[model samples]
Target: MISESTPLAAVEQAMQALLDDVVPLASESVALGEATGRVLAEAVEATMDVPPFDNSAMDGYALHHSDAGHTLPIIGRVAAGDSPLALERGTCARIFTGGALPEGADCVVMQEKACVTDGHATLPGDVPEGDNVRRRGRDVAQGSQLLGAGMRLDAAALGHLAAQGIDKVQVRCKPRVALLSTGDEIIEPGKPLASGQIYNSNRPMLVALLEGFGADVIHIQHVPDNAEDTRRCLREAALAADIVVSTGGVSVGEEDHVKAALEALGELNLWRLAIRPGKPLALGRLPGGDGQLTRFVGLPGNPVSGYVGAWLFLRPLLGAMQGCTAMAELPRLWATSTFGTSTGPRQHYMRVRLDFSREGIQAHAFTDQNSGVLSSCVGADALAVVPPHSQVAQGDLLECLWLKA
Candidate 1:
C-alpha cells in the first residue's frame, strides 16, 4: 500500500499499477444505429475504393487531352450513376457531376470552356490531362485498413463505415460502474437538510460525468460513515459492476472507513497522492460476483477534488477497460499564465479559464482555490497544472488540461 506522504509522481505509477491488471471487457457486434461512442473491437478494412471508379468532379466535357481546341461530335451525355460509355477518337461526352468517365477519355474540360453547339463540342487550348477528374481510390484504397481497433466511433467514423457498406461493427461492451457516496452529513438533494447536513451534489455530477464517458452506472448508493455499512455497500458494488467508485471515507479521520473496508475485502494498492485538493485517493481490486476481480477507486469527499480525481483517474481507468489506448493520458495543451502564485509542498491543479490572444493562449486561475467551492468550476475551461515548490510568475508557460469535450 502507498503511504500518505508518497510523491505526486508515485501516484501516477500507482495508477499505472492498477491499470496493468485491467482486463478489457468482451466485444460484440452492434448495428450502426447503436455504434456511436462505442470503441471498435476489430479493425476495419475498405472492401472497395472510395470512388469505386473514375468519375467527373464537375459538369464538363470528357475527352482526350490531344483533342483540345478541336470541334468533336457530342455522341452521348452521362449523368451521375450512368454506366460508362465508350468514346471514339473525335468524340466527347457531356458529363454532369460525379458522372463516370468513358474508357477512351483521359481528361475533362469545364462546360464553360467547352462551347457545345448542335451536336459538336469545342474545347479550349492547353486543357491538361486528368483535369476536373477524380481518380478511383484517390480518397481511400480497397483492402487498406480504414479504422483500427479501440477507436471511438464518432460521426465521421460512422460515415466512413457506411461508405464502406458496413451495416454493423464489433465494439467493446460499455463499462458498468457503481458509484457510492459516503458520509452521514451528506443528504439527497431536494430534501430538507437536518442539522449539520448538506445536500449531495457529487452523486448527480458524477453520474452525468460517468455517463458522458460512455460508462453505464449500474448502481449508485449513499453509504453512511459507519465502517460496517461502508463495507456492505462496497461488497455489493463490487459484485454488481466492473468498477466501483466511492467518494469520501478515504481520509485518515476516524469517520473515514473506505480504506478500512477495502482492506477487509482486498488490498488497498494506493492510499494518498501529493496533489492539492485530491490528496486522498485509494485504488484496489476486490472479488467480484463472477469470482473475477472488480476494480475499485476511492475519491476525496470535496466536490472539486472528487471531480478532479474522476478526471485524472476514473476517466482513463474506464477507457482502459474499454480498450482505448489513446485515453491512457489526459489531453493537455500549453498555455501562458496570466497570473502567478507561490507554491507549496503539493502539486496544484488550479481551476482556470483560457483566453486566446494574438501572442498565445493564457490561463487565469480562479480567485477561490478552495476544494469545496463549486462556483470556481462553472466558467473554468481547464485545470492548469502547477508544480510543487516552484514560484510561478506572470507570462510563465504552463501545461493545461481540457475539462470539457
Candidate 2:
C-alpha cells in the first residue's frame, strides 16, 4: 500500500535492486570509428602516445628556444605528410599545423608574428620555452590507460582514442528491451478505434524513448486485458529480453492484472510514489521465459505520466547497463521563474520554456500542466522543478531540468 508515502529515495532503492541483476544483454566488437555512443566493456589503454610525436600547433616556424629572437635560416619545409625532420642550430622549419615538429626543435613561432625576408625569418615575440610546443607523449603517453571500463563513449573521448591510433575497442553490448501494453480499451494506430478503444500512443512514444536511450526494443506487442493472456504475454516477454516494460494494469483496479501475474510467477513489489502524476507506477521481477529471470517496470497509463516514469527511473537503469557510472544524475540547470507557483507535499515536474536575452533567463510555466496532456512535452525546452511543499516567488531561483533527456 505504501501508506507512509514513497520517497524518491525509496523509488531509487527499488530501481537499484533491479539494476543489480543487469548485465550487458550481449556484446559485439566494433571499430573505433563506429563506437561513438557505445558503452565500453573493458578499459582502453593507450598503446602509443597521442600525436605520436611533437607536432606543430599552427602554420609557423619551429626552432629551438635559443633562436627565439634572432633570425634563423628557413632550411626546410614540413607539411602534414612529409618524412621525419632533423634540425640544426639557427635553423627553422616552415611547419604546417598538425605536422610533426623536427627533432631538437622545441617552439613554434606563428608566421604572423615573424617577418620572412630573403629565406630568413625574424621572430618578433619573446616566445617562452615549450611555447606552442605539443611535446612527444604530452597529451597521452604510451601504455597509459586512456578511458576506463564502464565509460560510455562520447565525441571527445572518441577523438582522444583516435589520436592515440586505436582502431578498435571492446564495448558493452546494447540491451534489448521488450515493450508490451495491456488493456481492453486500446487499439493499434493507423486504424479507426472503436467507441471503447483509444489509439495506442504510449507504446510508440515509449518505443522512441527507449531507442533514444540506446536500447533496442526488439519486440513491442499489444496484450489484451484478459488476465491469463496478459500473464502469458508478460511471461514470454520476460524470458525474451533482459527487461520488460508494460504501460498499464499495475494499479489495484478490476482490470489490473500485473500484480496477480507477478504473484503467480515470483516476488512482486509496488510503491505508491509521493510524486504527482506517477503515484500508481510499480516495479518488480519474475521468472520469465527460457528459464531466465528479468526486471519489469510497470508505468502508469497516462502518456505523460508514463513518460515521466520512464525518464526518471527506466532511463537510469538502462544507462547503467550501457556502462555509464553516473546514469541516475539528472542535469541541474538554474533559471528565474516568471511567476510564483504552489507545490504539493509530493515533488512536481512543471513544463517550462526559457527566454534568454539581455534581460537574462525568464522561465514561464505551461498554463496547461496536467500530466495527461503530452502536448506540453512536445515543445518543452525545460522542466521547472519545485521541491515538496515549497512555495516559490516570482523572481526566485528555480531549478530547470533541460529537455536534453
Candidate 3:
C-alpha cells in the first residue's frame, strides 16, 4: 500500500503493475463513416496501389522525349478517366490531368511550354522523361501495411483507409465506466441549497472528462455518506462497468465511507500519493461477473482534486482498455517558469498557462494554488511538475504535462 508520503513516481510504478494484466475490450467491425475516434484493433493493409496506373499530372502534350523541339501532329486527345491511347512515333497526344499516359509516350510538356497550331504542337527541347507524370504506386503500394494496430483513426487515417477502398475496419470497443459521487452534503444543482448543503460539482465535470477520454459512462449514481449505500453502489457498478470511479468519501474523516466499503467488497491497493491537492486518491479492484476484476479509483471530494486526478489516472486507464497507444500517456514538455514558488514533501502540480514565443516556452502559474480553486483550471494549458523539497525561481526550467482533451 502506498502511504501519504509515497512519491508520485512510486505510485505510478504501482499503478503500472495493476495495469499490466489489463486485457483490451473486444473489437468490432464498423463502417469508415463511424470509425472516427476509434482505435484500430488490427493492422490494415492496402489491397490496391494508389493511383493504380501511370497518369499525366497536368494538362499537356504527351510525346516521346526524342521528339523534343519538333512539331508533331496531335493524333488524339484524352481526358481524365479515359483509357490509355497508343501514340505512334513522332506524334503527340493532348492529355489532361489524371489521364492515362499513352503507351508510346515517355514525357508530358505542360501547355504553357507547348505551342499548338494547325493540329500540331511544338514541345520544349529540354523536357525530360517522366516529367509531369504521377507514377503508379507512388502514393501507396499494394500489399503494404497502411495503418498499424492500436492507432487511433482520425480524419486523415480514415481518408487513407478509404483510399485503399476499405469501407469497414475493426476497432476496439469503448471502455465502459461507472461514475459515483459521494457525500450527503452534496446536492444536485438547481435544487434548493440548505445551510450545510453544497451543490454537486464533481459529477458533471468528471462525466465530461471521462467521455473526453473515450470512456462510455454507463452508470452514474450519487451515494450518500452511508457505508451500506456506498458498498451497494460499488458492487452494482463493478458488475456493470470495466472501471468504477468515485469522488469523495475516501479520506479519514468520519463521513468517509467509500474507503471502508471498498475494503469490505474488494482490495485497496494504494491509499494515498505524494501530490498536492490530490493526496487522498485511492486505487483498488473489485470482483466483477465472469470472474473478471473491475478497477476502482477513488478521488477526493474537492473539485480541483477530482479534475486533476481524472487527467493523471483515469485517462491512462481508459487508453489502456481501449488499446489506444497515443493516449497511453500525456505529452511532456520542458518550459521556463515565469513564476517563483517553493514546495515541501509533496510534489505540486501547479496549473499554468503556456506562452509560446521566440524566446522560449514559458509557464505562467495561476495566482491561487489552493485545491478548492476550480477556477484555476478553467484556461490552464499544462501542469507544471514542481518537485518536492525544491524552490523554483523565474527562468528556471520545469517539466510540464500538456493538458490535451
List, residue by residue over 322-370, the lDDT tens digit for candidate 2: 8676566568788899888887777787878888888778898878888
Which regions of candidate 3 deviate over 4 angstroms?
Answer: 1-9, 190-192
lDDT tens digits, residues 159-228, model 3? Answer: 9999888899999998899999998889999999999999988999999999888888999999987888
Provide the TM-score for each candidate, comma-separated: 0.93, 0.88, 0.92
Question: Which residue pairs clash in candidate 2?
Answer: 239-289
> TM-score of the candidate numbered 1?
0.93
Error of 2 at 246 (Å): 0.7
TM-score of 3: 0.92
Each candidate's clash count: 0, 1, 0
lDDT of each: 0.88, 0.80, 0.89
lDDT of predicted model 3: 0.89
RMSD of 3: 2.4
Worst 10-residue lDDT window for candidate 1 reads: 1-10
Deviation in Å, model 3, residue 73 alpha carbon: 3.4
Runs in model 1 lying further than 4 Å from the true structure: 1-9
lDDT of 1 by residue, 290-329 (tens): 6888999899999999988888888888889899987777
Pairs that collide, model 1: none
The alpha-carbon lDDT assigned to residue 55 of candidate 2 equals 87
